[model samples]
Target: MKPSETVLEIDLKALEHNYRYLASKVDDNVKKLAVIKAFAYGSDSVALAKKLESLGVDYFAVAYTQEGIDLRNGGITQPILVLHPQSTHFQEIIDQCLTPSIYSEFVLNHFIASAEANQQKNYPIHLKLNTGLNRLGFDPKEVPMIVEKLKQTSSIKVDGIFSHFAASEDVKEKEFTHHQMDTFKKVSDQLIENLGYRPLRHLCNTSGILNYPEAHLDMVRTGIGLYGYGNSKEVDQQLIPIGTLKTIISQIHNIKKGESVGYNRMFNASKDTKTATLPLGHADGINRIYGKQNTNVSIHGNLAPIIGNVCMDMIMVDITGIDCEEGDEVILFGKDKSAEVFAHNAGTISYELITSISQRVKRKIIP
Candidate 1:
C-alpha cells in the first residue's frame, strides 16, 4: 500500500538481517552491544531496541542519560550504557537503573558520590578510556589515579572498560587504529592487575567489527552497522538499509519556457516543463544543498531533478517528460534509491542525512 503522506518507513526484516549479518562476524561468545542513540539514528529507537532485545543482544548503548531512561520506560530491561553522562543527572541515572560511562575524573567522582549517598552497592559503571579519539574518556596516564579512586569506593564497580575509534573505517588509518588497540590493551592489562578482575573490554565500533576482528575483545559495540550502513561501498553490499524515506506528489504544474518556479525563482523553465511539488523540504530533512538539481527523487522508477531552492515545507522537482502526477508515490530514498546515494548527491554522509530527519515526520514500521 502506498503511503498518503511523507513517512520514514523502518523495515524490521532489514534490521534483523543487518543484525544477524553483523552477529555472524564475531564469535558466539563475544557479546554484542547495540548502539541505539539519537533515536536509533533517527529511526524509532524504542521499537528497534525492543526488536534487538528479543534477538538476545547482550547490551545496548545511548549517547545520554535520558535516552537510556527512554529505553527503560519503553520496557527495555537490557543493560544500557550511557556513553556521555553528565554530573547533574547522576541521581536520575541511578533511579532509572542506567549504567553510566565514567569518562573523566569529574564524572567518576560525581557518580561515586551519588552512589554512596544512595547507599547503592556495586553499582555498575563503565570506564571510557581515551584511545586517540580525544573526544571523551580518561587519558592513559590517569589509569593509576583511576585505580586508586576505585579502591576508595565500593559504591561503584567497574563493569566494563571501552574506547571509541577515530577512524576504524579508513584503511589508511589502520596504523593509528592499531596504536589505539595497543593502548587499550595496555590500559586494560594494568587495570586488571590492580583491580584483580577483568571487566568487559570492548573497543570496536561497526567498522572495527568488520575490519579488525582481533580487536573484538570480550564484547563488541555496533551502531551504524545495526542500522544498515557499513561505512564503505564493499561492506555496505553485505548490509541492508533499514529505513526508507518516502512522500507523495502534492501537486503538478505545466509551465511554458521562461516561467519561474519555487522561492527566489531559482528555477526558470528553459523549455516547456512539467513540475511536481512534494510535501517535504528543508524543514523535513532534505537540506537546501540538495536543491538546484543537486539531487533527484524517484517517481514511478523515473528520476526527477529537484528544480529550485528548497522551502520550509516544500520542494519542486522537474518531472518534465516523466510519467508522474499528483498523489503518485515518490521515493526520496530507500533500497532502490539509497540514502547513501541521496546524501552523496548533496555532499554529505548517511549518518548526518538520516539522523537529520525531523521528529515531526511520521514513522511507519514494516515487516
Candidate 2:
C-alpha cells in the first residue's frame, strides 16, 4: 500500500479483457494461442494462466517444457505449446500432453521416439518453418525431407505449420515483409502437398494479424499484444494497456546545489531539489540503461525524472516542487506510462522488458 515497500499489482480482469480484445481481433476460423511464456511476461504465469483457462483461451504457449509443466500442475487442461523445448524432456512432454514446435531433425527424432515409446498415436505437433527471421524454426530446404521422414513415424502427427514475422508493423518495409510471407506460403504449401495434410497452417504474430489477414489460416501465436503492450505504438493506441507496475518512494531528501545522490555521486544537484528514492532498481527488472535518458517515475500523477545511476535495489527521482514525501506511491511502469516507453528508454521491446524482469519483485493479483 505504501510507496517504499511497493507491490506490483496485476489486474486479472484486465488480463481477461486484453485476452478477449485480441480474441475479438481473430476471425472465427482462427484460434488464439495465448503466449504465457516467461512468467506471462513477468506478471506471474501460474495465476494468469489459471485465469486464462477460465476465460476459455483456445491454447497456451510457453518457451520451455518446465513452464508448460508448471501450468499442467496448476490444473490448466487447455493445450500448451512449448516453443523452445529440450530433448531431455521428451517423455515428460508426452506424459503431460504438451505440444512442441518442431524446429530441426534433432527435436523431431527425440519427439518421434518419445511418442512411439509412450504409444502416443497421432500426438499433435507444430512445424516451425524459418521464413526469414532465422532465429528458430526449420529451414525451408529441410521441410520436404523432414515431412518424408515423419511419414515413417507411427505416433507423431503434424498439427500445424507456423513461422514468425520480423517486421510486419513497419509498413514502410512492406516489400521485405511480403517477401518473407511469400516464402513461408510456398514452403508451407510444399509441406502440405508432400506430407499429405496438416490441421493448422499459421504464420502471424500480433502485428501480422492486423496487417495481413490472409496469413491467419488456422491459428495465431500472440505474446505481447495479449498483455496489452501492442504490436507497435501506432497499432496499440486503440488497445487498452492491461498491466500497471507501481513502486513507492522510501525516503525523501533535500539537497543543496552541490550535493550529490546515488552511487559515485553521478548526479549532483545543480539547483536546490527534493529527490525521492524508490526501493526499486535494476534488480527488479528496471534495467540500469533506463537511468539518465528517457527515464522517470510517476509521482502524484506527475512525471519525476530519475537522477544519478540506478542502484541495484533503489533509484533516485527528482521530486522537487511536488507535493510528495516519503512513503508516496511511484509508477515505475503501468497503463499510464506504458511498458513501451520503458522499452524505448532501454533500447528494447516490451516483450524483453517483461521477460527480463527479475523474480525478486512481489507480484500482487489485484482487482
Candidate 3:
C-alpha cells in the first residue's frame, strides 16, 4: 500500500498487548468490554473491533447506535452496547441486535414500547444508573420506580447495569469515587432484589480499572487505556501506545534573521534558522494552538519546535541545528514523542488530541 503524506500508523501488536495487559489487571470471571466509540477513538473501529473480538473480548461499546450498525455491517458478531442510544434509533437498535444503555424513564419506557411493538421477547438492554456523573443514567433514587416499570415490561430484558465515574482518574476525588461506587451498589442491589435476579454489573472505566480494582464488578469497559494510555505517567509506562501519527517533511527553507514565516507573522526568526514544513495542521488533528512555541514534533530523535500559526493543512517547524532534510520521517506523537505530552503542551488531554485526527488521514495497520 502506498503511504500518504500524513498517516496514522496503528500498531496491532501494541494494541493487542495493551488489551492483554489490561485484562490481566482484572479478575478471571470479570468480562472485558472494549469501548470502540468515536471510530475506536479515531483508529478505525471495524479493524480494531475485529482484532479485539478475535482476542476474546467479551463485548464492545459505542457511543451511538449508528456506530453499532457500522460494526454489524463490518461482520462483527460480538455483543455491542450502545452507550447513549436515542429513542428514534430504538427499532434499528433491536434490528441490529445492539443492546442499549437505557438511562431515563422515558428512554426505558420508549424502548419497552418499541420492543413490544416489534413483538420482541427478552430483548437485551442495559440499565445506566446515575451514581454521580449526572451526565446520563437514572438517579439512584429512581431505582424503585425503575424496578416497577421493568416488572410491567416483558419485551425487554436487563442484561446489565452500569454507571460512569466522573473522576476516577483523579486521586484527589477518591471520596467522590467511592460515593459513586456505594450508590451504584445500593441501586443495583435494590434492582436485583426486586427483579429476583441480578444483571451483569460494571462501573469501572479505564482509570477505574487501574485505580480501583475492587470496583471492577462483573465487567469493565475501557476506551483510552486500551489504545495504550493509562491516564497517568505511572501506569502509562506499562502500556504501549498503539497509534503513531507520522508525516514526512514536505519542504525545507533557510530563514534569514528578521524574516517571518507562516500566517500572520506568528514566527519571526531572530537569527538565521532552518524551517521545515510538514503536511499536517489543524485539519489533520494538529490544533492551531500547538503552533508558535506551544508544541514540538520529533525529528531524528530531537525536538522540532512548531513555529508560526498552524495552518489548515500545513505547519512550519524550526529545524535549525538538527540533522534533518526534506522527506525525513517526522513523528507527531509516538514512541519518542508521547501523545500525552503533545496534548499537555496544547492544554488538552490525549483523548482529544488522538480522537481529533481527521478521518481523511490515511490509517495503516501494522501487522
Candidate 4:
C-alpha cells in the first residue's frame, strides 16, 4: 500500500469487536443504537455506519439531520435517529424517513405542524426528556401536554423516549446517575400511561452501559465505546482502539547546544540533539497545547518527546539516540501509546482529541 504523510488507520476488526463487546453487556432483547455522530467521532461515518449496518446493529444515530442524510446518500437503509433535529429540517427528515428526537414544545409543535401540512401519517420520532442533563429535552412537567398534543395529531408517532446521562462514569456521582434514571422512568411511565402504549425507552450511553446495567432499559446507545474506549483502565483493557493516527518523519536535523527548535524558540537543545520533523500539527488536530514539551510521539517503539510549539503544519520531536531516518513511521496515538494516554498527557480527553482530527487527514480502513 502506498503511504500518506498523515493517516488515520481504522481497524474494522477492532470496531466489530467493540460493537460485539458492548452488545455482550446488555440482554439479548435490548437493542443497540450506534451513535455515529461527528463523523463517527472523526473516523468515517458513512464507512463506519456501513460496517455496523452489516453487523445487524438495531439502529443508528447522528447529531443532526444532515449527517443522517449523508448516511442515506451513502446507501445506509437502516433506521436513523436524529438526536437533535431542527425545525427547518422536518421536511427533509420526513422525505428521507429519518426519525427526529423531539425535545421541546416549540420543536414538537413545529414538527407536528409540518407533518400535518405534508399530510403525513404516523411519522416516527423519539422524545427526549431533560432528566437533569438540561442541555436539551422536554421538561418532565410537560409530559402530559406533549402526550395530549401527540393525541391531537395523527401525523406523528413516538417511536422512542430517551435521555442523556450527566456522568454515569463517575463512581462518586452514582446517586445523581440513579436519580436521572428514576426521573426518566417516571416521565416515560407517565407518557405510556397516557398514550396507552410504551415506545422504546433508552437512558444509557457508553458509560451508563458499563456502570448501570439495570438502567439499560429497552435499548442502549454506544458512542465512544464503539470506537474502543471504556473511560477507565479496566474496561478500556477489554476494548481495542480502532483508529491509529500516524505520520512519517519528513526530515531530520542535527542541532548543536543552544540551538532552538520550532516557533517561539520554545525548545532549546541543552546538549547536541537530533530531531525529526513530522508532517502533523495543529491543523491536523494536534492541539497547540500539546506542544512545548507537553506530548510525545512513538517512533520505532520508543517515545520521542515533542520539543517545541506544535506548528500549523509540522512538529519537531527529539529523536536523539533513536535509529530513525526520514520516512520512518511515527505513531501519534495508536496501539503503542493509546488515544486515552496521549490525550491525558495533553490535559484533555480522548473524545476531544479524536474528534478534533482534521478532515484533510486521510482515513484508511484495515480489513
> Which tens-of-lDDT digit does each residue in 141-238 have in candidate 4?
99878988998989998899999999999999999999998999988999989888889999999999999999999999999999999999999998
Evaluated at residue 163, the lDDT of candidate 2 is 87
User: Model 2, range 1-367, lDDT digits (tens) per residue?
Assistant: 4634656778887787777877777887688888888889888898988888787778889999999999999889999989999899988888899999999989898888888888888999989888888889898889767978788987988888888888988889789889988998898888888777666877888788778877777888777877786766776775666667788778899899999888888898889989888887888888778776357778888888888888889888889888987777888778778888877766777877777667888788875
Q: After superposing candidate 1, which stretches have Cα over 4 Å from the reference?
A: none
TM-score for each predicted model, relative to the true structure: 0.98, 0.95, 0.98, 0.98
Native-to-model Cα distance after best TM-score fit, residue 232 in candidate 3, in Å: 1.2
Model 4 misplaced regions, further than 4 Å: 1-4
Clash totals in order: 0, 1, 0, 0
lDDT of each: 0.93, 0.82, 0.92, 0.93
lDDT of 1 by residue, 1-367 (tens): 8879999999999999999999999999999999999999989999999999999999999999999999999999999999998999999999999999999998888899999999999999999999898999999999999999999999989899999899999999999999999999999899989999889999999999999999999999999988789999998898889999999999999989999998889999999999999999899988999999998999999988998899989999999888867899999888778888888988988998889899989999996
Residue 234 in candidate 4 has what lDDT? 94
lDDT string, candidate 3, 118-155, tens digits: 99989999999998888999988888888888888789
User: Weakest 10 consecutive residues, lDDT, candidate 3?
Assistant: 1-10
Query: Residue 109 lDDT in model 4?
Result: 94
